[model samples]
Target chain A: MQWSHNMRFFQSYAMKKQLWIIVVIIIAAILPTIIGAFWINVAVEILIMGLFAVSFNMIFGYMGQLSFGHAAFYGVGAYTVGLLMAKLSIPFSLSLIAAMLSAGAFALIIGYFCIRLTGIYFAILTLSFGQLIYYIVFEWYSFTGGDNGLQGIAAPHLLSSVTAYYYFTLVIVIAALIVMWYISRSPFGYTMRAIRDNANRTRFLGINVKRYMLINFVIAGAFAGLAGGLWGPFNQSISPDLLNWTESGIPVFMTVIGGSASFLGPMVGSIIYTFLNAFVTGFTQYWPLIIGIVIMLIILFSPGGIQGLIDKWYKHSDSSDENIEL
Target chain B: METGGRNSGSKSEREEITGESMDFSLIFSQFLSGLSRGAMLFLIASGLSLIFGVMNILNFAHAALWLVGAYLAYTFWNLLQPYGFSLWVSIPLAAVALSAIGWAIERVLIRRIYNRTLSEQLVFTFAMILVIDNLIKIIWGVQDKAIVRPSIVASPVFIFGAPLDSYFIFVIFTGAVVAIGLWWFLSKTKYGHIIKAAVFSREMVSALGIPVPKIYTWVFVLGIFLAGLAGGVQAPIGSITLGMDNAVIIQAFIVVVIGGFGSLLGTLVGSIIVGEIYAFSILFWPDGAMILIFVVAAIMLIIRPWGLFGTPMRT
Candidate 1:
């Protein structure tokens, strides 16, 4: 059996090209279960953060906003779920739903105020909102456990099996990614790209630019929150550190490292970053310094990022296009 | 963001009625404490503003210069401590040493990134912050170190019927001197005029044969040196620690935001406002103070996105 370049390449034996990507996703989902537990867990982190970074790209790459405070939504998701399960006796699945909605709601409010600003002002406003959330979480000691963080957050018993959890996460990731992919290709995405490419031109076209910005911003926040929901149960806890500006930068860095413009670029970057982080921490205490240096070098020299490098190499070697979907 | 909701809680009123202890003379000392911190903030912030305004480079690693100053001050103080050299002497020497370090950073790392966007500049500077902070940790260890207070500053001075530490007076003096010197440099000198012109239009200035890149290098070096000087002056009052860089940078950032990004007078007014707020808030509401200042900033941003004194950018 041979793989077809296009599902619609043959008129009678046709489907959509996106289905090929879905098939690849299905293979990725199953391959992890057969892998070792540690690798599976690491794959889960990559998937989650990959999702997180891509969500960030919606605002940063597509909308031309530079947010230094996205961890606000991520942390809200974590803490919302953590507090709900701990205090309100909410079911885990419902808690995740509630967490995502509330996070989206918060993003909507923050995005409403923030959409009015542009460039660095938008960055600062988002940051201030993030800091405000950090303050509340840090100070509300009795409820959020303050700096110590809420601990011992157990998932449903079915997810106690690492492989089971892997499959479960794989399914959710596929769903989430599809939703995000759909969002990016939708009319909304086109308008966002227009706004990013030329705000003045888009405004002159009679589009409700700020309204479109808020919609995408809230959607991105929702996906980020969903990613955070995965994180809390996987890690068994959430801390204020998860919500800080530094944590926010991880997604930004990974997105940049992976190639923010590509759909699957963040996934690739997260895998490399996570693996490198684990390995480097084992070898030396100064991991952040090394990582920081690498990030700087990459940004300065390789503006197109890892995916960009691969694309350049491919183009250089062959006149015919042989490119990865991402 | 909690929006300063008008339905005031009891906690809000409780914030309005706090009193100072009879050991209240310590209050004046603490007021000085805030002033010195304010001065340090001004030093770092003014440099950051200049780098932002003149170079159009939001170089986050500029914070590292403060750490460099503090570290150099620590080393100098240790060497001179055995010889009985006061912090006064060590600080100036350390400031000079850090100026050289600033020159090196400009020549090596910063000069290369002048053509980059603000986001790219931010990434470069962020990495530098991490690398420099950790290099200091590796060399100095994670432990904190302090410069000895000069004997003159150890003595108390009478002010407004309150006793103040002489070191506080010294801090105020250094801040005043630096502020005046910076004013003279910016407002009363030909170089200042060139830098201002460069700030507004790099291409036009370079077209006129002003050596714009050289000016950029000088501006960055001078900015970092001023930050280092601030750090050096702060060494006697505080410990030099790796994490010290973070808080100082944030405080500097707030000052920059409050001061109008590129204005020196704005930095001064902003620092004083923030300093006084922090000082009074400690007495009133311990937890709410920092958040309140940010709240003030958020409001300012909404009302005048350019800041109190900053000119609005052309979109």
Candidate 2:
């Protein structure tokens, strides 16, 4: 009787989580209808970045592998789509797919070598590569437009309307997030967390720890690429700076700001960053100053961010999952 | 952004004013140019490499320090413009001023997170990039500023078959002097040996009653001095702008990687290699040079792992 009652409670909680996602989708789908195109553009950017940050969180939070070159994938996706449309006159969907493949291929090649180093070595190595990509884009004037970047990229007919584009982006992001959420809950996630908590123990348990990390790495790179792919049509242009180390820092900032441990934190962090940028930069050119200071204070104080704060509040009220580690 | 050029170039030059205008002597001048550029690179990369060695922190702000040095030189030059002593006086003054800034950076910002993760180090330094660059723009106004080699009536000297600029020669000489100074400081002096001792074993050094944190501050200050000197020397050669920090800093990191961390000799050699690549690439294929160096650094790391002379990771 006691076991059956616990099972029933678990099922009820699972159902509530699923319903929560649906509610979010419904609200997100109708958001642009209520707001203007300007806000919608900001929303689109935030959505793309949310996917990027969440993808980053998978590696940084779940796997405890910090990468400063995530922008390589992001840039590869954006540039792949941009180059295809610029030169080959490829279809929108096809270009996006190509973008994802290119990003994955690029990630695997870099990761093959980078995986050898752990800790700060790995981070700096990735960073150098990220800057290298940026330089390629900046200097390869003949092919990459030589820093002027690819201009005049436009959304496809289906995505011509802001409302339509918002809905389209929302659908894709929702599907991606659902997939990510599922992956996070699967046995794979358990193994990942184990590896993060103690790599030697997991390896002792017969897991190919490096292989597990590589799989998560490629997957993270692909989703970040997907974010980059979406950015192409939305912005209608791309630049090599998109893959620079500084640009790669975004998701890390967002991941930490959103509390990397929780799946929902990064998405919320992205929303917060976007909304803040919308109002803040409009007021002055020195907005990064304000944003940087705020993030510093957040890191210094909260460490786990808003989700971290929420967890602490919930903890005081006696939640069932008391073992949450930020 | 594609700055529109030929998707397919014409078979021949549209206008060739050249009738074998090349000079064999240009090779010597090119070598001289390479050395000068190498010196500037050495100054920047050495500072960055040292910081990486002792602190085990990848500072994103070193390039900003370079920018600050150049800006200080510019400001001092303007203040002392009417007086003939400005050019000679400004460089040392620029370096000294920036040392205080470096001290503040170490004490206030970097000290706070000495024990944090690499991601935290990266994030905090990155924040400085935003704050520092914006501070530069706010203070200087967003206009390009130039630091012309203080009007010293410099003349070119002929070496082998080519004439080399005096300023270029000075840069090369400055680099050598700095290298020797650093080496002697590290080897002969007690403090220098203590730093290397700390580098070899931080805990052992600390257990021996030395203050590791104080050593870190000194390392940071010394590194800052070198970076400021680099900026002061390069003032005449390049543009002084807020964002120049990013380019210089990235290049410095690449050099540090190739040279291996904490090895000044490696930094010097690495700078020369990168410098030669820069000079020759511009002479030949301009597009892929910068990217090619990065590719080289990546390949070097794969092969050597710890860099050419870098100490193995004991941490």
Per-prediction interface RMSD in Å: 1.5, 1.6
lDDT of 1: 0.78
Off by over 4 Å in 2: A1-23, A317-326, B1-24, B153-158, B161-163
What lDDT score is found at residue B228 in candidate 2?
85
TM-score of each: 0.89, 0.90
Over the stretch B121-222, how does candidate 1's per-residue lDDT look in tens digits?
A: 776787788888888888899888877675666665544334456677677778888899988998899999888787677778889999987898889888
lDDT of 2 by residue, A1-326 (tens): 97777667656655765687778778887787688889998998899999999988888888887888899899888988888887888987898888878888888888888777767667777887887888887988888887888987787888888788888888888888889888888889888889888899999999998888888888888888889988988888888888888888888888777888688888989988888889888888888788788777777777777787766564433343322232
- Cα lDDT for residue A233, model 1? 81
In terms of docking quality, model 1 is: acceptable
Give the alpha-carbon lDDT of every model.
0.78, 0.80
Clashing pairs in 1: none
